[model samples]
Target: MLARVKLEKGCKSRGIKLSGALAAAGLIAAHSTKDLSDHQREKYAVVTLIDCRSILDPVLSSDYMGFYHSAILNTHDVSGGENLWDLAKRCYTAYSNAKNNNKHFTDMGDLNFLMCKAIENPGLTPSSSLRTAFISVFEDPVTDDTNEMHGEVGVEDYVGCSSVHGVGPSVAIFDTIRDGRLDCACVYPSPLHSRDQMQKLIDDMKKILVDGCANGESES
Candidate 1:
């Protein structure tokens, strides 16, 4: 339902700063398909869901019983050697453009119509599986999770996420910043992507983030 990420020692390139969701989304999509080599570029669509609670006309509270989120979809060409910062900037810019134009509010009806059409006729979606985007992230999380709160609640290691079993992206990222660390819950369809595959992808993404922080830029 929501996502959050941590940025350390922000790096600005072309005056565009990188955020956690954009950077992670681009990198995941770029490295998604192993079939493409570093020389080849592939197009990947990312759907970012923004919580509309505060932005809604009526202004809903966090305790609102229903889903009050909107999605903004964007596509980018990615390569195996894609720079995380550059790709993140592109993603951010696209989202900003869409958000600035009120696409989230304007495009909701269109998206719903398309979703209904897809549901009525699976052939409208890729592989007739209802997969709309390659990846999905949250624009901003409503709350920040903390380890102290978890301890008081007697909660141990856990992953809070939304299931993408019906109609959604191939991978859904539920990211949260906890105790200054980024914790992500990745949900992918079963049998389509193996545990090993997702594990490798997660490892690669973490390495990119770590390296970016260490070197103050993305290595790949």
Candidate 2:
């Protein structure tokens, strides 16, 4: 998901993707309380989903769909106050390494086993809540706007979402771009994670993003 930079564009700069590690880093930093000692590092996990249609050996058309998205899990150790760009680079580096090694496919068996075990033994997850990861994002965003087909159906706008009240990450983000605007639908298990908590987390995330951009300072 770390797809912001194009080396060909001579962007000797770290990039952040809409559905990539940059988003995860922002969330992790937001979850870090100010009271946390600078020396303390918290471990956070994130999952990025990748569509296999274009990546398949024999690439298939987008119309041909059958649960083709695969996931790559990454764990980051955050000690708070880390530079956003540096953290983003680190997150991307880990994901890229794993993808290069084909961990998505190779780790499927183990992932399934762990999933089954988590279902059987809720204690395997946080608070025995079946919480597998902190966040889940897609590697790429789906882009579109209502077209002639939609005009016939009288569809002005639409959104895609799913029920994550069962076993899943704390936040599942489905991002899309329409008419050049990025929009995301987020789902989380309620009661388990109260609305206030998630709202505060999101507010803090926005602050972090705004501050990062406003300051315009990062590790070189």
Candidate 3:
């Protein structure tokens, strides 16, 4: 159930496609009340932090990469009080890049833009099946309007999906950290690369998505 989306020229596009890690430098960053201390911050120092000022250049800015790097440099950044504009801009960039680069972009609409479009779709009911599907596919409650989903409410399981599927170089990097098969605990905090691990992730995800679709059809 990984959903990927892209943003371009202020427009957001969506795709039902595939589908993170890192350490912190501060002692507090290394270990949080909810996270583990086993992953060393030094392992993630390579991640870069995004600047808030990079919001204007949607086309060429590397903010999306910066956002992913920020996640690893300090996964704790999920709640570090960054501004909404910065996060939203980064999300837009990430989604756009993902759509352009990943094969998963086919047959998908942009969730970010679709939300507003839905609001204007008089022919569609908010409770209609299509609306529900659109929201389910792209409007991640775990990710805010800015589309950042790191430590957001009810979204620990989604961090991996959001990182890759959102838009940006982070998608590939997150997959690497996932190293593939993430257990339900979803505790691994860095990019994963083991062949066995990736195979497992892909298999598990395919099963989940396929079964969900079947169940939805049966219910209808």
Candidate 4:
């Protein structure tokens, strides 16, 4: 709880949202993949799924959930031995700048055009082996208004609040907050990667977030 508060404060100081901070942490933790062979590490990319409903239309309220979201792709040279905080700030800055420029909306047409081309040329689609790393950060809907629906809920109960499954990424992280506490689930294709390895990566990501919150470092 204390760590959460501190992290939130740090994010506010830097004009970063909690989702952006978590995304940064996920990417930083993903740097550990450098332990793998160079060929394997070269294929690793970070894809952040961000909610765009708020920015889509100013008049539309948060309740208007029309599937307004987009994915931000960020590739890192983890071999450079970059600082975690620095990398995090860069990730957040890129996302912020892109959104501020209204690229999210403008890119929709480009995405459609690319999809059409991919449909014509299926060869353009990446194979399963080329899957990138993915992280999705979201807030659970267990608010005061809907508290009655989740009677007798606890931290552990939040585990069932989210579900993630797909072939697009080798590793996918689903993150959410319930009752002011953060919860995350890391999933990977079983035969492709060992559960123990993925679990360790997830643990490292959590530790990074907690440490960032506890340290109360000023924005760099």
* Number of the candidate with higher TM-score, 1 or 3: 1
lDDT values for all models: 0.68, 0.69, 0.29, 0.59
* Cα displacement (Å) at residue 219, model 2: 9.0
Tens-digit lDDT track for model 3 on 1-220? Answer: 2222111111222222222111111112222223444343321112222222333345445335533211112112223322222333343344445444532233234433554555566246333322212111121112223323434655444453433222122112222223223222222213433555544544444343344334434543
**Per-residue lDDT for 1-220 in model 2, tens only?**
1122221111134454555433544555555844787677878888888788988989988768577878888988888667655576676777778988999899988887888889899998988989898888887777766555787999876788665345678878787765655566777787788888877776676566545544443322
Give the per-residue lDDT of model 1 (tens digit) for 66-102.
7778988887777776665666667778887898999
TM-score quality measure for candidate 3 = 0.21
Could you tell me the lDDT of residue 132 within candidate 1?
A: 80
lDDT of 4 by residue, 78-187 (tens): 43344556666766777667767766667768755764665566456565332434554442222223434567464224343333343345565665555565555666
TM-score of each prediction: 0.82, 0.82, 0.21, 0.70
In model 2, the clashing pairs are none
**Over 4 Å off, model 3:** 1-55, 58-193
lDDT of 3 at 118: 50
Number of colliding residue pairs in model 4: 0
Kindly report which residue stretches of model 1 are placed more than 4 angstroms away from their true locations once superposed. Answer: 1-6, 11-29, 62-65, 217-220
Where does candidate 2 stray beyond 4 Å?
1-12, 147-157, 163-165, 217-220
